[model samples]
Target chain A: MSDLASKSVTPGRDASASAATGYRPSRTLPIVAEIRRQASRRRTQLALGFMVLLPLIILVAFEFGGGNGDDDSNGGGAFSSLVDLATSGGLNFALFCLAVSAGFLLVVVFALFAGDTVASEASWGSLRYLLAIPVPRARLLAVKLVVALGYAFLALFLLAGTGLLVGTLRYGWHPLGSTIAAQIPPGQGVLRLLGILAYLAVILLVVAGLAFLLSVLTDAALGAVGGAVLLWILSSILDQITALGSIRNALPTHYSDAWMGLLSTPVQTEDLAKGAISAIIYAVIFWGVAFFRFTRKDITS
Target chain B: MYKRQLQIVVATSDQAFLTPAAPATYTVAIDGQLTLPTLVGTPIASPAAIYWYVLGALLAVVLLGLAVLLLVRRARRRRRVTAVNAELAETPLVVTGLRKAYKDGFVAVEEIGFTVERGQVVGLLGPNGAGKTTTLRVLMGLTTPTAGEIHVFGHRLVPGAQILSRVGALVEGPGFLPHLTGHQNLEAYWRATGRPWEDARFDEALEIAGLGSSVHRRTKNYSHGMRQRLAIAQAMLGLPELLVLDEPTDGLDPPQIAEMRRVLQRYATDGRAVLVSSHLLAEVEQTCTHAVVVNKGRIVASGPVGDIVGESPSVTIDVTDVPAATEILTGLGVRSVTPDGATGLIVDMNGTPRAELVASLVRAGVGVDRVVPRRRLEDAFLALVGDNSRGSGDR
Candidate 1:
């Protein structure tokens, strides 16, 4: 002990030589890590995998049930009825698929994605460590938004791609013929497709926004995701009430039908434009509220 | 030989000696008449130029606002008197009668108040559920106190970017993205904190963490010690004025724990104040100069580490003749002599020095033996915590 003490007292030793370096306390890296983590989860992978297989299954069912010629003279048969349904610029098979995907499945997926983004960190007891680095709440929310949007878009794009592939193989990619007394030439069909994809992107953002808001309000990912989806379902049910028609326009899921306008021969731009505007407004408002609440909320629990 | 030695002394003395030089002063006299430099070629004042000036003025106002925010945050740093003086000009991080209770009204922490000096490493030592974590959360603005005010750096704890920029922390387990490599996790953390991407200090932090080439590996693969190191690394990233760590070395091996101690020591040397909470008594004893011990959500003891671990006077006498030595020590006013197995006797000298005891023992015809001071902080800490069953035989 005496020898050790003497050695410590020896002069000329540089005390700071072994100082640790590269300390960075921030949330950006953790958010990115979270994104990668969520992507690899069994449930997420399963959801994405099933989404990829859905269109093929639907197309096969359509083919086995006999082709478009099965329609009766009154357009009452399954295939012709599907065509007739498309004519209303609202309830066609294409619109049906889109509505189900966006209004229900997509909302759920987005809720799961955005809702679980931060809440998962909290549940795993990692939120304290992430916040400990002096990360401002705003920047943390921003990264979460980006990751959620990325996943939402990826899901939408994959669904759209699958739909196109199946539709082309079964009906042939001649043109996206409209039910609303419009004939889109095959040459301009791709443009309409692009417009449809863009519309879906906007619609998905609304879902993502709602999920993000729920995520910020709660620490349980399941609660946040379920809450957003429940809200979506409730809003959709409310939209069905004829007396609340005007108010229904404000519901985030109301814009799910906006892509139907893209199928018109002359391409009806009115409702599509309105829907886009509504989606943008909803996105901004939801994100603003989420950010404000996140910044102010005490994360003690 | 005498002449040569005299010559050497004269030369050495000449090299060492010097005469004091006169103080130099410079005086300048300014003319009373005011003079302006000639205007350069009729200053052009176009309407567009006026708009530009307006824009510039607006920009300057925005810039000034940003600078004020930065200054306020800097001043909020715990011990940094410069920023505190510039802003509050007095109190920095004032937590007056702070209290926090869980939803069930179970008090987790209550009435805690302490001031941290700039660049000092203060240890918060306590058993599990002692409210150290709760106290840190309140300080970081993560959890609101049930009662009382908390002023960080100098700004009142608010949900603002400026205040967070000047502080850093590592609470509980290292919350990191499992899929991300340690480096990526840190990068993401930096970006989310509103820090610039090109922060050079990040590299230094990584190096300090001893992660080396392993920083690029996913955190899921990192050992507990490595993760702890990574957490410490991430906390030190921005040279933040205030750093808070909770149970930083809970799972670390001895070497890693030592490394963490060293890293924290370096952080304090930079004039950055750190508050680290830990259950490991030995780690706190080695690293902390000041400490606050919390028990059941209340501060039981606090102050300098030396003071909290109260000094006790005892001497261990190792001699060939133990029986004789014990008898001799008892005669020297040593009230108690505890046997340390078969080899040594722990004589309670009761503030008496070894020399005096030795002389007395020698006068009594007892063979002289080696005497050593005994003051293990571990022993004192156990006593302080009221755990008498912590010694070698008992435990």
Candidate 2:
């Protein structure tokens, strides 16, 4: 074997043997194919449907279960402030829905997309066939990652888009206002919403990264998704401890709600900046590890 | 003059967000437009945000740089591992010095090796837990071997090697996405290989599958035999140069099994090769041109089926008088003779030419109808593997 190591990979017969005539490793398992494969699954449809339906449910709750009771009394808290300004305009209601869901709902949705992609294939026993098809392991992971993130992004967009549409229709289109001395025109409000959504996407990157890593490590999709969400909950819990102090700032969930700063008059950049940076750093590390571990795995499943 | 006017306009706009208590710091009247400003030291953008953005960009660059460096290192290592040996260049498959020891101290295959050549239908004959599936798994790059080199058409086998694209395999059992129809699953698999559809030879493979209209039904609704046949068809996609199937006839009825045997024979007749594994010695004897008998994680015997069956020094003769034939055979210099049935005799030739026995029986009063080799592959297999034919526990 050691003597065999000095030889080149193929001696003139590479093009004529082994691979089929049209096979190309780079072209295998395109992202579109993976997206199509995942999109047809009932879970994906349910997930996207739930994203749209959640906002509608929230709107129905706001309309029928009306409680304008003591909005002013619950001041000084970020969530309470959003609640007080929920009906001020369509943009405010959309912002409120985002604020309520970004913490847990969006985290779970992102985890489901990233965490279930590879593990589901393994559970179905199709992974071995794909790997033996010689879909380069790195290319497979890359395609899955791209598709997973694409679906996650689509889910986020649907949630926010549906919220905006429902909120606008229910509460007439008006300028975004809050308890603070800030007023944004309807057009400007939509632009700010885009920026907030971008920040939310970045913040959820950490969840996607963790779930993707866990997906490669396990064959059980539920375990991978549940594990990622559980770890995030643990991080959020740790972030709640004041004694942890600056250590909490290093936690990925610490900046999960930092997009709230975008609702300010001049746009409070302090927390938003910290959140984006922290999210990027954590996402890079988790996703990098996932790729490394995946390419070398024996793929027994 | 335009620069100063622009500055005053920016100042006037900045005053709109200023706190009501803030003092008027700068006031100017330009082109009949009044400019108002409050708060002298407020910056247009937060310095901290700019700092974090730069830091984030730098960190991203560093991470990507590290990732690229790692990828290059892995690629170099992979190239080194995949270097072509070239010794068995024309052979479709060659495995040497193969060994696999699982994490729990279970040794599935302890130093086993074999090869499948072009135009040959070879059977890996073994009982349950004899490491047949394990060997196939390693050869297909589904699992890593502890120590070995598998060369497919001269190139060393590695996980996701481009060389593997020429090899089609079904190890263990058929694995399909339950929600997809059989046709869709096969199409999806072929598409994932990134080969052109025209090269798949779908019609030929489907003809071999014989599924007909069932091909359109979801795989979840398929029975075990249907799934097995579909998996075999999937392995035949692109009419690959080498086909490796494990227990290909596991759940098939007798007719389906016969159909598969004919399919494999035809597949090998076209200058390609097939390596099939099964515990049924009779199936191997009927379907394969060559057999590699393995038991307890070791090769016990291997060669053409006839060669193995011929190793037994015995022949069965259909005769007009079994008692007379047996008595006459015993009188000759043979090892033993026994009556098999009403008109048959089993005789151990004991280094005697089969023609000699027939010549002697014809000269005597005994009438010989037919003479066939009594030693089937089953006998040779049992003799080669002996009493320890049962597996040593598969990993």
Best by DockQ: 2
List iRMS for all predictions: 16.1, 10.1
A1-301 per-residue lDDT for model 2 (tens digits) = 0111122123234534556677877899977788778877889999999989988898888788577864554857667878877877788888888888888999999999999999999988899899899887878988998999999999989988988998999887987776553678899999989999999999899999999999999999999899999999999999999999899989999988877677777777788888888888788788889888987777777
Report per-candidate TM-score of chain A alone.
Answer: 0.79, 0.92
lDDT of 1 by residue, A113-177 (tens): 77888888787656765565445566567777787777777877777676666565555545445
> Model 2 misses residue B38 by how many Å?
5.7
Here, model 1's chain A TM-score works out at 0.79
Candidate 2: how large is its RMSD?
Answer: 10.1
DockQ of each: 0.08, 0.31
| Candidate 2 residue-wise lDDT, B222-328, digit = tens | 99999999999999887777899999998999999998898888777545789999998789989999999887688878888788756578888999977777777
True contacts kept of each: 0.22, 0.55
Error of 1 at A259 (Å): 5.4
Q: Highest TM-score: which candidate?
A: 2
The residue ranges of model 2 lying beyond 4 angstroms of the native Cα positions read A1-15, A67-76, B1-47, B50-54, B70-82, B85-87, B314-395
